[model samples]
Target: MECLLGLLKVKVVRGLNLAICDPLSHSSDPYVVIHLGQQKVKSSIKYKTINPEWNEELTLSITNMMLPVKIDVFDHDTFTKDDSMGDAEFCILDFVEVAKKDLNGLPDGTVMKTLHPDKDNCLAAESHIKWKDGKVTQDIFLKLRNTETGELVLHLEWVSIPGITH
Candidate 1:
């Protein structure tokens, strides 16, 4: 049993129909916070809009594919504590599978045939393949959900390290 290190890239693209936390005002300032394992990253605040385009990227070193990544949307409040808008989560193992194509007894990258929503009630997102540094990278779109109230779009990439197993 050998362990390998993989790099996970998460890009918070945008939000759609986000929750308006401030009832006193017409709109609310919103931002996104992403959590992977013990690492957390926050996107820049988008003021006065329900739909915001962040286009921000964060990278994390991943050793376990069984863990789920958590994403939370919040309203930025200057006076008080930030209000929670909504949240969603997804697991890497949900997309990754053992491929029939193997190299030297190691499995190759598995292709996801269809986009499907996870247990978190998020919309199905798109996925594709990207090559970098002579290795395969799994790129996926993560659609964050606050039930039917709101949705967020995120781009996630899993970069595989050579000679890594499991």
Candidate 2:
């Protein structure tokens, strides 16, 4: 956790660093984005491989709203000759809430909605909120359709908070 000076009060970042490499193929670099409400916060992770893999750890600031933090990863396709070929994976990790003693289990889960593909345009797949054990923090996977190809693609897994929950 780190502290920063804000306008009025101090802002605390109690977030986890996520390292996502080439999930599907080792050739392309992974593109990552953090969605805070309707605004999309661009992360440092981009579509480029340094060593054997590409990695980036993003810090998500905790807020008071019951907002679902979404992480969208797209394959670096611009480098390739073909611009149309790429895979975009979307994931809503968890809600940002103050670290409280009573909030062991995540009261609300993420909901998926179908959308058109384009920078924060539309979500291809949708799901409803389902409460589960707090201790069980695993990647929630979802399948979405690529608007161009209309093929079902596997999106990124949403990681849940570990210590705060049961």
- Candidate 2, residue 46: the lDDT equals 39
Q: What is the C-alpha lDDT of each candidate?
A: 0.67, 0.33
Ten-residue segment with the worst summed lDDT in candidate 1? 98-107
- TM-score, every prediction: 0.73, 0.33
Task: Give the per-residue lDDT digits (tens) of candidate 2, residues 39-94.
Answer: 46543433434221223333444432344544454444545532222233333333
Deviating ranges (above 4 Å) for candidate 2? 1-27, 38-55, 77-99, 102-139, 142-166
Write candidate 1's Cα lDDT for 74-116 as tens digits: 9999989998888887766644442212323324443434455
**Which candidate wins on lDDT?**
1
**lDDT at 113 for candidate 2?**
27
Residue 54's lDDT within candidate 1 is 86
Clashing pairs in 2: 112-126, 112-127, 114-123, 115-122, 115-123, 116-122, 135-166
Q: How much does candidate 2 score in TM-score?
A: 0.33
